[model samples]
Target: MAKMRDRRVAPSSERRKNPFAAATATRADKTGDSASDRKLVTSFVLLCIVVIPAVSVLLYYVKNAPRASHTISLAHQRGLIKTDVTYQEILTVISENASQLHRHYTYPVLAYITPWNSKGYEMAKRFNTKFTHLSPVWYDLKSQGTSLVLEGRHNADMGWISELRMTGESLVLPRVVLEAFPRELLRNKKLRDKAIDLILTECKEMEYDGIVLESWSRWAAYGILHDPDMRKMALEFIKQLGYALHSVTSVRNNKQHLQLVYVIGPPYSEKLQVHDFGPQDLQSVGDAVDGFSLMTYDFSGPNNPGPNAPLQWIRLTLQLLLGSPSSRVQSVGWKIFVGINFYGNDFILSEGEGEGRAITGREYLNLLEKHRPEFQWEKNSGEHFFLYSDDNHAKHAVFYPSLMSVSMRLEEARSWGTGISIWEIGQGLDYFFDLL
Candidate 1:
């Protein structure tokens, strides 16, 4: 009895010492105010959750708010317009753009390729899809008949020098490659021979869809445009070029026809108009070659904000081409590729600086279709008519289209039996392959 009492006394003493020895009997309610504490803990956790994310998003929006809503690449940024294009990849893009075009026009467009700054051949080799490329092998405007490549300063942003068509002096080039050609090579007879050798070698190895002589207007026009001797020499060179292309195509036993294309112009002294070029100018160029590629852009005065070679002017020119006795030659020869803008028509300025839209080719569609839904192209006014504010901005883009607009460009192409060439290769015209 004494031992049992001692054991019980020991257990009780241990319990008292531990202060929490009633473990089996004790519960959460005994230890604390359970309901109120739980409520307080839940409220604290919920407040933490609500405040943290709201603060994060608020900070993010604040940081991005200062950025201009519509700024693309900044002005100082290089507008090189390059892609890390593989040969196969670029061909794919060509096929893609071609296919999208097919949906709009049942007749697949005669996809005419334009030469890139220095990347022509590399671009040509990528595709087996046969199209047109305007080769630089023909008489270069810079060196005239003396050299294949142009050698002069790149054209000013205004493109004013070509407007002037310097009489006795050298004209400036609008590309770095031509501007940087070796002077010694051009001056020395032996070097000139070697230069021709190098150029022909590359051009022969990789054939273009066609060849375009630089400023054919300057070269083809006798006396009125340039010295008769220079004009005669240039024409002789063009004849040789035409014959040579005929031989190469003949040798391949590929009856692939060549289009000898050229960019023509009226001098800077004269006002630029479609009527500026008459039947005689077209006739002279047609006699030299297969087609006329009107660089139908840059017709506007220097720094004009109007559309680059507006459709009004374009329609006038096209109508002339379509109507002329040169129309026979014009039908096949009329390769009218209206130059689309990679840059703006001119700057929208802020205090004499370009503080305007860096409108891209795709963005033009927005003006015609999205921004001003009701705008139409007026023929008599010879421009896209729209309402504008006194602030000198094009407020509503109302475009004019009779038969000459994009609405009928390809349709008319089919009707008139001519080619419609755009000044580019890549865009999002891939539905043809994808629909498969």
Candidate 2:
């Protein structure tokens, strides 16, 4: 019994003596587990590092993009047009029969209200006058008074309601007006002098009218988006315009032009439809303009598939503008006037559809009444009409306004106690005016 116990004990004793073997096995197992654990942890850490930064970068760029796609001009920047010989002759002829032409209280220089003014201004006075409109403070635009003070140190001015004509290769403006800017021109004494000389000579040639001075230009619109260089140039250009106006005021004998520089500001014509007002394209259009004249009735688009200017849009737009100037008071510059669509936006189809023609209000109404009697339109207000449809397809037809319709619109405009302007003397003027 003692020998057997000794044999079992001897095996245990031998195992205990081989300490290196046991230790080696234990060490190997521990090393393998530790290495595997380390790999798992490292992979998780690396993934977090890569993914977090990537997502953050993606989110940053998407948030900062432009909303109201801007339109690029095909022409370079230049001054205002002095006159349109063809249009001038035609207008002169139309104005001759003043009694037949139906005159009204008028605003000519609409700095920000062109839509109300630039039509055929019926005001008998050859000299233009406009009511005041204040620029948007959020966009850093100065009102006429503020703008004058800003550019007084420099020499830039505004021009609106005065005239716009193609003169040689450049536009010959009376002066540029606009919102204010944070630019400096005092440093360039030489440039300032040259600008002054040019302005004085031009003012003398033009020979009359008080100065409508403003210091900035369309830069306000561009600034809404943030283009440092472009804003700078625009501001500088406005300063130059001011210099021109300043010189004019110093020498001019006429006082009519100063009392009212009709500002012509706007809703950018080329802009695409948006869910909300955005990318103020017509931002600075009023800055230098004496009056505002909008291309209000442009229903004939190259891509239009349906009726032109809807009454809802027209009325709402008029209301929106009313925020700046009372539609009633704005009537004074009705002569300065917004433009109505007498022609189509294009002669050809946009995406290959119709010939892209524009129908006059009378024609549009006649066509609608003849084709879709079930769809009707009643006059809403001054030269304005609307569609009436009970069918669910959301179909709209242009109904000719009845004599009552014309009368209603005329009365609505008259309520503003202002002037009214027809777009062009030709191209169906009598069609709408006849109703008036």
Candidate 3:
């Protein structure tokens, strides 16, 4: 029994002390670890070879996927796929883009308001908030002896000023063409200096924001084009007026400097004799003044029976005003405010006598309402018109710019990054307000 117990204890002690056995065990552990490491490296290599290529193909397919296919897939997923886009869908997209544009874009809108017409005063009151500047046609200047004299009477009940003031709109005085005015007065340095003094004094006293110089008298324009001296005097007058006006601050806002706006007729070809207004005048005036109110309308008036402002003509005019290599209208740093006609022209179709008669937008609408005639839209000119026979058996054709045409012009102005100035406020149709 003692020998058997010793033999069991001896085997346990020998196992614990056996160096060869320990070495063999350590060797086996090392062999297992090497196999595991080899398996892990092999798995990594297989993943790189297979998964990397698969991921690269998927990424390429995603990046180069067809837009229509992707859209269709998204629509199908939402169960909203359709065969075609409807008109309403297109309109919705357009309206959304317009709304975004409205939110982002902002510029000045100047409206002319005549004080003589009660309707105009009312319209100015009604639309004060829509306008940034309200220019009242209440002032005119004439050469009296050696000094410039104010010729127009101011309205005693000038409530429009208060109304505009309440809406934070500016009041600019409109200087109309001095009737029967002699061009020689412009050449007189003393007279020009007196005129500048008078204008600045009145503006300061009335607390006016600025003045709109309606200096584009046909005779004056003709003289400027024909006579070099007249052109020089005119340029000098603009420079002096601009310098004087800009030097003074308005009493209304002590920090605000006076603004000078020069109104010029539509730009015409340099080669054309008797152009509406000379391009040289525009370039020079643009240098002196803050802006130029390009009178783009009156292309068709009592004398001419056509679209008031043909879109193509307007495009050419704008291009010229902006300047080109061969064009006479060169760069003269200034902002442009395009004029939009709120009136229309009516022509008597019989005998072509008394052909072109000016009519307001409201008048045009009233005639349409009474006649109920078939109206047609001229696509080329962007004008709406109708031919009708009066009770006297005389035929008449009326051409006018509807809101659609106005909108197109406005879009053009916006595209050119220019402001818009309605010819007159009261003459526009009621629906025209909605466009603004």
Q: Which candidate's lDDT is highest?
A: 3
Q: Which of the two, 1 or 3, has more lDDT?
A: 3
C-alpha lDDT of all candidate models, in order = 0.32, 0.30, 0.55
Badly placed stretches (over 4 Å) of model 1 are 1-199, 207-210, 217-224, 250-253, 257-259, 266-278, 285-288, 319-358, 362-404, 411-416, 425-436
Per-residue alpha-carbon lDDT of candidate 3 for residues 75-117, written as tens digits (9 for 90 to 100) = 2333222323232432333344221101111345677765544
lDDT of 2 by residue, 315-386 (tens): 334434442342243333233344333322212212234333434333443434443333222222122222
Query: Residue-wise lDDT of candidate 1 within 69-107, one digit each (tens)?
Result: 212221112321122212243233434443211123322
Q: Indicate the residue-level lDDT of 382 in model 3.
A: 58
Instruction: List ranges where model 3 is wrong by over 4 Å.
Output: 1-105, 179-182, 218-224, 268-280, 324-334
| Cα lDDT for residue 436, candidate 3 | 55
Q: Which stretches of candidate 2 lie over 4 Å from their true place?
A: 1-102, 105-200, 206-243, 246-253, 257-265, 268-289, 306-308, 322-336, 342-354, 358-422, 430-436
Q: List the residue pairs that clash in candidate 3.
A: none
Between candidates 1 and 2, the one scoring higher on TM-score is 1
Best by TM-score: 3
lDDT of 1: 0.32
